[model samples]
Target chain A: MQTLDQERTSAPPKQIEDLSLLGEVSHRTAGVSRLEMCIQCGCCGGSCPSEADMDHTPRMLFAMLRAGMRHAALMSNTPWICVSCYHCVVRCPQNVHIADVMYTLKSMAIEAKLYQDSTAPDFSQTFVDMVEEFGRSFELGLATRHYLKHFPLRLPNMAPMGIGMLSKQRMNITPTRIKGIAQLKAVLKRAKEVEAAS
Target chain B: MNKYILYPGCSMESSARAYYDSLKAITDIIGLNLQEIEDWNCCGATEYLGIKLTPAYALISRNLALAAQQADGTRTVVAPCSACYLNLAKADYYMQEQPVLGQHVNEALAAGGLSYKPGSLDIRHLLDVLVYDVGLDTIKSKVVRPLTGLRVAPYLGCMVPRPDYEHRWSDYEYPVELDRLLNALGADVIEFPLKTECCGGHMTQISPDTAFELIRRLVSAADEHQADLMATLCPMCQMNLDAYQSETNKFFHTSYRMPVIFFTQLMGLAFGLEAKDLGFGLELVSARNALAKIGIEHPAEIPTGTARPKKDGSLPMPAPLPRRNMHTEKGKVVK
Candidate 1:
């Protein structure tokens, strides 16, 4: 896995126009239009709480999308780093849904198999797995699997908090399945089929 | 009694048990009748929607579909978790606004022999329903302990107020509903300038340094204002600010233990509910010092401003930038 530094220094992939990322995304979802409306304003970046940690600021990512650098934008840590705080979306002068655009990039990234940096993506998948398994989340299980996978070293530091929570009866060790888990799974399976059909 | 459906997103069961417990306790006092949506799944949170749209929306909308089935003329569905509430409301609003998306989502719902018409259910955040539906004055009437001595900085985080399709929040940038609600509890509500600021959300898990910067901004700002504690409405915000505070402090070489508790938890406390029942000790940063204020006679007034002159001559926070009115010409935003 390339470190964030490597990811940042990595060149924008030879400006390939095999597909216009922005155009493809807009075509897929009509909910977005203001992509063409971005004034290249720095509102999204400036308002982003985690922009400094991102490989590309939201503004730069948008510019890359407009420039059709799909590979570069998709591989960047920008989309993965977004916490969906939505500060930028509401603050955008042009009313561009910056958060939604990040969502689009994440979907595109997953579809194209471009997310080589795996910590955040893995965390997301772990979360989904927990939910999918029981219909409700299992935090202790999710945290153990996640930290032991991506961040074993930090586990010791996090143990005290975990212990505190456990002592307080805050951490439920058992995974509780929703009564309609079968129905939820069916809906999810069908949703995937619908997505694939589209 | 105000009746509505409650979708206690997964976190309410495990990580935010305090929130779930306190919300349950407060509702009884406020006369809110919440019908739990039978067998609701996760709301897909902030993670799933980014990974896949249809399935994620379906996962969230399935809950909506189920709520619609059980609405029985009470169409409102309230979620206490900000992310769950946002996802549910977004699914409902976007499905109504876009036909193709709605059709695709409903197609998925059909497999489970369930279907939800767009706008069939009223999706709302718990804070919205409490402040708007319950009314502050009515809440004020029930506050047995009046929280007079405890000074709280009302932190709304980012989700509850923004992209409000229902036009419920008073203002997107600087919503005063939380402040008003806390005031109705008779707590001294500090005029927190960063009330609507991002609480770094899941960045605490993904990038610790980035999350610390955001957390520090909120915690230190509250500390600077001499707030006894910081109260928020979102489970995500409480976890980030309260649980990760010391980690943030360790990273930034600063020491701050600004107690971040859920607003509903505070509400339960003011309604004369037991602190243990409100899940007070679950917070990594203890609110005991702040809560202990309840024991002493209530202070009539506590001054809020620069606690003392900054010896190093640090300037006060800059005036907030004026919002750009969207109706103006393209070039109207001055650099």
Candidate 2:
């Protein structure tokens, strides 16, 4: 509920105080080559749909990693803005797992408390929490909680569409849970344990 | 009847219930038997994979383990949501490509007495199975009313084609399977250049400006080509391009009411199914105008020259360029 809480007093933005995000991401993506292979060919940046909004191009971010400018790279909004489109990964000359690299960067940034854009992270945490609780995402619940928490002004604007969906029976208020949620929970717990232990 | 397991991801149950309803309505007609997995969990989507690696993989693998447990003889698992399909396929592909990842995932699986072999089951998107396995001939035979007047932009979004891992796609950047499928149904299919483009998945909920820019590009392109509606295979794409379309237009100060709909819903519509059963009115940007072109409510009338394309036949698909690493102007794919 920490992430799901609606009344978040906006925290003051801060520059990244650490410089280990690059090494941490590299460790997460070991064995099958890593981000170090990026040729800085600009393929990822070229194919990016949201590149205009990103503070650093993906290629530039890779350059930052190589140059050991961890603070600047982590502070950039590139990782958060990535839509996971995978346009760069499949198009890369060196076969860099660009999208996966972004995922790693994002997770590391959140762990280091570097990311200031809370909306994307909040949405992710809310989605994970929904899955953790019911084994499935409840749409009305997720959307309601998300908008009410982050953008209350947007809800009234969305009412007509919400009513339209409801009238068509597309909006279900109750989240249907699988019968074996206990077993699912056990698996998730063990997985978390295994991840932590590693 | 063809039998396979179905993994209707979480979206198909709630936000994409229209997809679920329409898919169920057509499977019987298409001669498919989709047996549900006994019990499954969420795929964690793109989010969980970002937050935590092992737990995310484990969360997704639980479903595969359960599906393997419930296989009974069939090994193919079909997921309707693109995100779910990609996540499921990634678990299988990556677990094999990197063995240590597999070892970690299985260790987590061992806790609940569930385990999955990387190559045990073939995870497929519903569109792939429908297009390849079901074939286009059977689909054409079943279309009671051809979508003669309605022009459609077949949008496959980003995930399904690229990073195919299994070599299942015809081309990475511009796969013509959806366009061909829509063409065979007699709709006036356009040469939509952005068919395989990104829909800024989950970005609408994150950054409205970035998402709207992406949405505006696709919507405006479809509108520019004078397409009556844009048909899609992924629910996330459909929701972003359809439900949030109004918001996107307002943000951009544009007024394009292009309707984005699921391909299966369009298939259901062409199969002579009722509009209500096909989940027509669920989209925020209503398809009434597009449907009216086909005379859904009124008497079947021939569309005027303005509504028709330059030619009566479907637009020819771009020539398949040999795969190369170099980037170009057209949809030439690197993979």
Candidate 3:
């Protein structure tokens, strides 16, 4: 796996047409119109709780889009810290739909295989594994697997927390899969079709 | 009479059974028909969409499509689980927001011989329906056993209110619909600051300490408010607060036995429904003791002290506003 640093240095500037991935999905989704409504106001940036942590604020991102600086927008850590709080959309004076735009941007980045993060993919994978196996998110299993996947050496560290949760009967160690896994698989298939068509 | 397609999710059948039972009982009493979507799948909850966006959303959207197909006329889809509600709403919102994602997901759906028309259904959290459709007046009327003496801290969690696509909730940071519902039930609702705080969701599994710390803040705040119990609409919040209270205490080396019950369960009790029938006893942190404090021995009997206003009509009303001087120093008359 190439580090984000390596990808940053080696990757060429992403062209605006590369954003077509977003257009494909955003077309059928209200997210596109929401993105179009962005007036480059700083409400989304100003309202973000974790704005300090982001390399580009939501406003700057829109500004980048308007300026056609696709590569800079795609490579920033702004999308990762969004927290998906629709506060930006709620607070925007011009009704700029910030959250959907952020999601589209994130999707575009992921599809381009740029701006790789160590934790997000593992977190996403853990979620899929749980659903595929049990037709739902097994909290304990997901937590344990996520920690194990991300921090292999921290296996023993989870004991204190695990025991703490276990004693309270919060951590159900026994895996409980839904009755029919085929139904979940079918759902996955259907969603993929939606992803493709849009 | 509002009819909706119900997506009970997995927790409603297992961990949060009381939510399902009480919602059913109350909706029935209110004359609302909740038709369950046939062959509904898991919502991917808090974790799946994070792992693989396409499949995670697909998994959730598949259920929405099924609910929409199953909808006779009503376009609203109601989910009791906060994670389920958020996932369903998020998928629907995103599919419309990102056409490429919509295309990809639709293509995936086509493979399964199922396609979803975006925006076909309005996804609503259970609390939204209770507050909006079944107004407080109607809820107030059904109070056979008022929770007058009981004090409850309403917990909304992070998912339900935020990113509220349908505008179902109040301010994301401090929603009061649950508190309003409880107050209408005659319970002393506490003003909790961490009402919309994260219950660590699935973070408890990935980072126990982080989850514990978050849970501790919520539980501790409720305890500080002298709340008799914590009322929640989200199963994940209920699970973390109820099932993990003892563990959180152990981690912090403190003791807390606060019972976490579904808001619907408390409503069921207030509605004079059977306590056992509402699955009150099924909770890991039993609410039986709390129920006893309100003079509710069993669900059948109307608890004492829950009577309506006396014939004399002498009930506490809001204090009348103090008379204001008509003229100001500048000789401007206040309207």
Candidate 4:
């Protein structure tokens, strides 16, 4: 059994620049390799509840990639609909790390400004902003903001619903910020240093 | 006393006040000192990152920087909110994973005169402290009233265990920490399969249908399992499952009145603390009936009709199984 440090040392470096035109934003080693480990066994697609709705299932995505259908595989909505349940990761016989790959691919697709969806990007951005602003996700604030961003027209209609939610104390209006923002900043810096070295 | 820096995030004051209150009460009893990080900010929950990557992480990193400054040699920062714990842990993990991303975030932090060294602090969920720091044995020793015959479904939600930076948890699908804790308290813990499923996160706002479908699965699963109540470590999970059960029911044209409580509340109950002290009355789905099943009655009376038979027909009887010694060293179970 290899120690965690040994595993890290033997693991391939995450090469961001090698993953298409998105350049540094796309992690090649982390994304495609995660997809490559899939034996096209369909375990992930089989277990995925959302696989039916997806244009290309996770298994098909991996199989297509292995067959050199890069454009077709990259263009599909297979990665976007993933709920990140980690069911695929847990059930994977080959330790394919599908969810992580999906995340990396999604990041790449977003950076490349491809596969633009009205709701997904807005949702992802809203999530990122919540973390950035307060060091925590304020669900009430996030839900309200996400709706406004994705469905601006729906805001007026949502107001009554929002009020109803607030009345029931289901939606909290105030946002909570984490303490010691400085230490968090340092950790980010150190992470940058490590990333730069890698 | 183990002094830890506490990051309450925003929900603790309002939506998750019960979790905040119960955590404070439980920690006080365990002789643990929790110091709140002064003037922390919101951890972009699940939205900010969806909008923009660099700025979103930078925003969360700022909080970690402040936490490090106030560390006082206690490297562990405990977050009661699942989103806070996930965001903080993700920022820390990714900063080490991607350098350019970390540099940009650090530059953003420098403007605030605060910086953090990656891995400077061990960001842990409050559940971790209770099970690991306080130890199940210690908690068991303090239980004035074992939660005799109370059936609980341990709901972890998503976030905390996944993208797990420190590997402080067990199997992602079925982490037994909370289950083990409840069992130690003598509660009849249910083996809930959807324990780690997503609670729709901010999607409850973006698309209620989508959110409702996800929430329905969890509630129905718990209901299917015939769990008396659900216990959660994440405020969002608790908030979504507890606060949205009615709306979700309306949307799905189904009825479910499952009470969701913070795990700390159950801990308080096992310790013989009054339900009110644990903020049991604050839940949208009243825990009164669930408590009544265990002979633990609450002041707010739940309608008698809501009480149903345990799914397994084993109500008021502990599941017949060999009892393992509850007090084991941390990380031993994982190996």
TM-score of chain B of each: 0.87, 0.88, 0.87, 0.87
What digit string (tens of lDDT, one per residue) describes model 2 on residues B1-335? 88899999887876787788899999999899999887777888889988888888889999999999988889999998889999999889888878888899899888888898888999998888998999899999999999998999999999999788788889889998999889878899999999989998988778876787789899999999999999998989988888788887777668999988899888988899987887666777778888988888622222211322456587888976663322233344422
Q: What is the DockQ of each candidate?
A: 0.33, 0.33, 0.24, 0.20
lDDT of 4 at A31: 22
Q: What is the C-alpha RMSD of each candidate to the true structure, in Å?
A: 9.6, 11.2, 13.5, 12.3
The better-scoring model by TM-score among 1 and 3 is 1
Per-candidate TM equals 0.88, 0.87, 0.72, 0.76
Instruction: Assess candidate 4 and give its lDDT.
Output: 0.71
lDDT by residue for model 4 over B194-280, one digit each (tens)? Answer: 998888765565555567778999999999999899999888788778777877776656889999988889989888888878877
Clashing pairs in 2: none
Please give the lDDT score at residue B159 for candidate 1. Answer: 88
True-contact fraction per candidate equals 0.64, 0.66, 0.39, 0.27
Q: Which stretches of model 4 miss by more than 4 angstroms?
A: A1-43, A47-49, A59-76, A90-117, A126-142, A145-198, B98-101, B299-335
lDDT of each: 0.82, 0.82, 0.71, 0.71
What is candidate 2's TM-score for chain B alone? 0.88
- Put the candidates in DockQ order, highest first: 2, 1, 3, 4
CAPRI-style quality class for the chain A–B interface of candidate 3: acceptable
